[model samples]
Target: MTDAADAEVRDGRDLYVEHCASCHGAELQGQPEWRSPDKGGLYLAPPHDESGHTWQHDDSMLTDYITRGGQAVVDDMNVSFTSGMPDFGMVLTDSEITAILDYIKSTWPDRIRATQAQRSQDAWVD
Candidate 1:
């Protein structure tokens, strides 16, 4: 990779550690009991790794979720639910968000990455 791309991924890793590690985990392991909701009905942060459903989503949806937060997305879907995830729209710029996502994507295996890329492309086509 080029130096600039390397730098962006590094920056993304740093930003993710600073902003997301608390709930998501330093290694992106996510919180415990993440699939189950709490007593208050809020779901814990899910892993960003291959174990989780992050790879199932397209980039645009992921970007929207990051920018708008889980609650907004749930609300848009008209679901009666609450989200512990907070919006980063005001806190991070678009490119920074992209970098953070890139860093997360970098950890996935080749097959997963290709699948996600196709999903992203399909999203745009649809």
Candidate 2:
């Protein structure tokens, strides 16, 4: 019999494949040398694994990231430039976004999950 956690992992994998794997990578490993600057000059794709900064972000911010994509602000100007990331708000429903986030959370270790929970609570207030 498959473990419940295993099932959850499978669901997460499905979500990742349908929504995130395009840029984030097929294994949640993110792009190559994701932490380093790439030819485009920005960091490629940072890992969402425990080694990544995803744990440092909160749910609210994560939600915004999925909804708004990434914007470049220079000298107080907001330029609606295309980012490596896309806004999933249109392509995927809120529930789907939530599922994607759930999948990410499911992959995290306990300590990271707890920290991210705190970050989620603090996510836009300060």
Q: Give per-model TM-scores.
A: 0.96, 0.76
Each model's lDDT comes to 0.94, 0.72
Whole-model alpha-carbon lDDT for candidate 2: 0.72
Span of ten consecutive residues with least summed lDDT in model 2: 72-81
What lDDT tens digits, residue by residue, belong to model 2 across residues 1-126? 258656656776798898788778776778777766666766566677887787787787677777767542221246533346666777877766776787888888898999899877776567
- Which tens-of-lDDT digit does each residue in 19-100 have in candidate 1? 9999999999999999999998999999999999999999998999999998999899898778898999999999999999
Instruction: Name the candidate that leads on lDDT.
Output: 1
Residue clash pairs of candidate 1: none
What TM-score does candidate 2 get on C-alpha atoms?
0.76
lDDT of 1 at 119: 100
Query: Which clashing pairs does model 2 show?
Result: none
lDDT (0-100) at residue 92 of candidate 2? 73
